[model samples]
Target: MAQNSYRRPAALLAYEVSWEDLDGAETEVSPPKLVEQVDVPATDQLELMNALWDAVTFDAPWVPETSEPLRLVGHEGAKSTHYELVLVGPSVAGGSSPIMTDPRFAGEHDAWDDIALDKSVDLFLDQILVPLVEVYGLGNMAQLDAARLSKMRERVRLIYDKHLMGLGVYLKAGPTGYVQGMKFVLQEMVENSAYRLDMANMIRDALGESAQNKVSIDALEARLTARASATAILAVVQAVLVGTDVGKVMYDLSASWPEVAWSAVSAPALFALSPSEGVVTRDESSVKFTVLPKGATSGNYRYRWTTTGDYGLLSDLLLPDAKVLDTREREVWYFHNSPANIQDTDRDNVSVEVFEVPEGATSIPAGAKPIARMAALVRGDTRVIDPRLEVNSGATPADMYDSGETYPCVEMLLRFPRDPKAYGYVVSIVGMGGVGDPRNPNYHFRTGNGNVDYRMDNKIGVNVSDYRGTCAWYNGFFGGDPADWPATEPDEIMGSGGYDASNETMLLMLFSAVDYDDDEDLGAEADLWKEWARGATFEVFPLYPEDAR
Candidate 1:
């Protein structure tokens, strides 16, 4: 919206101070002095002319029908002073006396008409213009920018229209009804004055430091509230008396007031995670977590883990004999025995048993060895182990065991330590040799052809929880016709496998260690084995709950 251009012909009103003698003769004490010059849009021309006439004809009561002028009575050494007003403007050729005959006046002249006109002018100056001038200079309404002034005027017009233009209720009720409607508008403005001022200051601050101190919030609020009430009351009264639109009058008047600036609201900051570390039970059905920067009281937040894929391996917790092996082809833990080879007939004859020993045990369980003695080989890719034992049975008679113990056997006992942190563990044993010699073709026994057999056994402790079922062990002999062997590939043949147990107290695997057949015929004598132990590898994972996303 554009700013109002208050351009029009200017009118000058001058007044002379005078005193009257007791005989009813008047004498001028001072020459006429300029009071004010007024200019307004063409729409307001008639109103301005009427006010000028009233100010100039204020002495009408003293002029009686008999054509005798009344004298001013003196009191306590002071004489009453009278003001004789003269208006010079385009509408008035000689003075304001001609205004009564102007067609714009549109009424029969009478003594009371002069009196009411005089009062209207007095109210306009004393109640409306004076208060506004005290806060802002005359014709300096530009202090309020065009857009802001337009908005303020729109608000005033809205209130006036809503309350006053109700099916002509105020028209039927007269001036009193219009006054009451204006009072409702004034009440709302007064109540919201403080809030509007605060909003204005916020806008000023956002504009930068220079605009912040342009006006004081408290002072501007007080002045504007008082001035608005006074101007609004006079505007309503004039509207009722002159049959003009109260909304337009208020809209026009608001353009001369200071602007209350405004701005848009900013967005909120990002939220933060509540707990630094998150932990959940292994194989738990659900996840629990918290996030913050909680907004309004009714607001809620969602959470999620940003990282993906399997949980990271706990490298530090890996056993001393175990080494993490990561390559383009595979990722696993390669466990090796201290002495890769154990030779002794007595060691081979006895069944191999593996067990986990507690930290403070006073005495070792009979025939039970420290779990560290049994090296563990764990595959990181599948996170499970497949143990297998292979034996060659078709070698010559001299190559076979003399005791007739056809199969080697091994036994293991696994126990969980206090407060175990891993989700589960895997243990596997792979062997491929037995008493046999393939070179003695004539002495071949039991279908000969150097037949090889495989088997596996696994057991879980009672304390274990959430046990995933075991996988089948591959079974077949290497010797018979290649087509007669197991349908699966030879190298893929494995023992009982793939069990997941949480909080496991103990586990056992039973098997016998036997010598490999002399297939190469190197003639190297088999060394005796006293105590035999191989490295055992394990893959452990800690459980974590899923994210809430």
Candidate 2:
């Protein structure tokens, strides 16, 4: 058959044969066999291939084809004949089957291998199986309605709020406060064993009447009996009373008591047994009570002390809880001395000194001389005076008295006071010489025409007169002319010398008294005779540590 033909021929057969008897009897013959030609359409051939492919694809444990021949048989007129059928075309021995090679059925033979079985199973579970199980299987066992679930959760919350929250509040009220309220209940319990019902009713009244049906009184009683005991209650009371004032507890307890016979009479009687003030160091303490009404004395009373005091004895009463020892040394000494003459006869004239007074001593150690003295002129004058002198002298003169001057100041590298308690110090120009009139002393005292200024560490500048008569310790100072000083109070200079606790030493510079005069009365010759005296003082302040406060 042509491979591309739309129709193919198939043979149908019927067979007949005449048999002769061995004894030469009459032989019987069948009717003539018939043959029919059938045209198997191409679609039928493809359908047959597809059927075979589906069997191989769907069946588990598929068997590979073997070379055994296959036959079809039919019986006719008591005789049976078999016809062998053979599949002919391109052999599928070492390559793909003819169905797979065909253009119409290409890739159809192995298409089953490309199927994603996992995805199909997942789709079944996600879309079909899961919803069916949830709707029917779980629905029969649980209420899955959103409204019913919400109501169930709300009921649980109501139970917690009505019962558990009230219990929490009652317990947090402390043994002293809540125990008094429960005293009547405990006394009732001791008198009668059937107290669980009463407790449930009491809880319902305290929490809400709606909870009467929800609370299981039997369960609550079982839990309470398992956890609570008289000995434990007494231990709690004893623990709270230790290091506590017993008299205060009695007074507080009395204030909450009713005006019944037990409270009015028995409570006061019990109070008489406890000492008005006493210490309780142990869990148990013996107390003596005298019954004057009955003319009897008893020593069986138990008392617990409850004050939060450092000293627990009657003799140590009224003492502070803790003593604050302010051991900081606040003793401050002011060391002042006058340097008789400070002058600049030559250029760059400067005098340096080391002024130190021992603690508790009034004066500097004897024979302590200036550390350095040189003929180096150093002076600071007002800007107005400095320019005028430069113009008149036809030469620019250095303003050595300014704190920034390095050459000609009386530089004192003073150490912080050795006292560990010392935190800060105050430097003051206590007194000055060459003030012609005490009543009208020139606030800006001058040698010739140069003004004197003091500086700390070549940074903080202040006029000597700012500290003249006042003992105020300021952490900052204003420089420049007095007219340029701030009308309002100047802002404080942070890290200035006054309260600086970090710096171990500070450089104090006192500028030289130099000749810068241009006035006729103050001659150039007056620079030789110009002299001044300054008396400065150092005072240290004490700092108390935080613990001492």
Identify the leading candidate in terms of lDDT: 1
The alpha-carbon deviation from the true structure for residue 309 of candidate 1, after best TM-score superposition, in angstroms, is 89
Q: Evaluate all candidate structures by whole-model CA lDDT and list the values in order.
A: 0.26, 0.25
Q: Candidate 2: global Cα-lDDT?
A: 0.25
For residue 273, model 1's alpha carbon misses the true position, in angstroms, by 76
Give a tens-digit lDDT track for model 2, residues 1-549.
111121111121222223333343433334322222121211112111221212222111111111211121233322223221212211102333333343432332232222212222222221222122121111211112222222333443444344323322232233343344233333333343444344333333322233335446566555445434676434433433332232233333233211011000001111111111111111111111111111133232211212222221111122222221111111111111111221111011111122333444433355654221111112211111111011011111122124221110111112343334533233344343444433212334333232333333322244221211011123234556543443211112211332223443342222211112211211122221122321323333434455236
Candidate RMSDs in Å, in order, are: 44.6, 52.9
All candidates' TM-scores? 0.16, 0.16
After superposing candidate 1 on the true structure, give the runs of residues whose Cα lies further than 4 Å from its correct spot: 1-142, 147-151, 155-172, 192-213, 224-549
- Candidate 2's TM-score reads 0.16
